[model samples]
Target: EYWWWSLFIVLAGIVLAVVDTLTGTMGMFGDSGLLGGLFELGVIVPSLALGVRRLHDINRTGWWLLLVFGFFPIAAIGGGILLVSFFLLDNFLILTVLGFAMVIGGGILGLIGIIVLIVWAIKQGDTGPNKYGPDPRMATSQ
Candidate 1:
């Protein structure tokens, strides 16, 4: 169920993006227009909710989603700032190396996190609810 809902959300986002691009309302790269922004705003809460539910289904804490989604982006952003600082500070060698390390490490870890989530989503949820709540499967049947 989580996998299916996640797929639907992704597909819907893709379709909206394509429509926005084709209609010249937004650019494919960066120039987001009203429609694109609205779509993003609309989906953000639901996407998070779905993610939390999915995590719950697996008997994992919803907090895992935060680590999965937040850590990498924050690291990458911090790395970017460092990289920019290195340039502004007359090419500090240490800053350059540290920035590169953070950015690359963040990206690699982010990819691994995504892959792990994907695998978990594919697996069966806890047999009879180890925690979080009752079995979603059982709930639906009644």
Candidate 2:
């Protein structure tokens, strides 16, 4: 159930990203234009739910996922600093090209890291509960 929900969220995010590109390029947002909002909503709500389920699978409260997502800006800031450093320190065009490459490559690496985290979270948890709460996959023997 959770896996399917996560898959749905990922697919919806892709669709929304495509729609957002079209809307932005066409200047389609207005009172009548809902594609933009729909795109955002398509990504956010399911993402939140998936994040919650992911934490639950790990026997952790869903709030931790919120914290992790919220910290993304910190990583972005670090990446931006590295980019600026490359620009300021590099004298050769080749080095500048490398700098751009690092930025894009780093972004991809970061995204992969996020995917890995989510995947790890969604996988099977301990046989019983650890610390967070009940084993969501099982019911108490009673």
Candidate 3:
């Protein structure tokens, strides 16, 4: 359910973006619409809601979505900042060693989080009720 909804929302966002570019209405009623924040109502809100529901279907907390999406980019940016600080301090060798370590560690963590999310999203959901809620399968049958 969420997978499909997300796909559709992403497609809609792309369409709106293209229309905005062609029409010179760079912010109207869509992703970045003339209506300002109202634009995100169609794109980000539904997508986020679907994503959260998707996580719930797998018997996981919606917070997992935040960790999955945010962990990598946040960690990687922090690592880059650390590396730049090291360079500014004139610690060349420390910059090389620690910067390399930071980047690699961030990448590893990011990859791990992505893999976990992939598995959680595709893996068969819980048979009945586990934690998040009742099995979607059962809900459909009734």
CA RMSD, predictions in order: 2.6, 6.3, 4.7
Ranking by TM-score: 1, 3, 2
lDDT of each: 0.76, 0.63, 0.70
| Number of the candidate with higher TM-score, 1 or 3 | 1
Give the winner by lDDT.
1
TM-score of 3: 0.63
Q: Over the stretch 23-91, how does candidate 1's per-residue lDDT look in tens digits? A: 887764466555666777887898788888888888878887777777598667868768686768776
Model 3 per-residue lDDT tens digits across residues 42-82:
46766777777777877788887777667567557757767
lDDT of each residue in 7-85, candidate 2, tens digit only = 7766765675576676663235442135645665556776677677666666667776655454455456655656666
In the predicted model 3, the residue pairs found to clash are 27-32, 27-33, 27-34, 28-33, 28-34
Error of 3 at 35 (Å): 9.8
lDDT at residue 125 of model 3 (Cα atoms): 76
lDDT agreement of model 3 with the native: 0.70
Find the candidate with the highest TM-score and give its number: 1
The per-residue C-alpha lDDT of model 1 at residue 103 equals: 78
Candidate 2 to native Cα RMSD, angstroms: 6.3
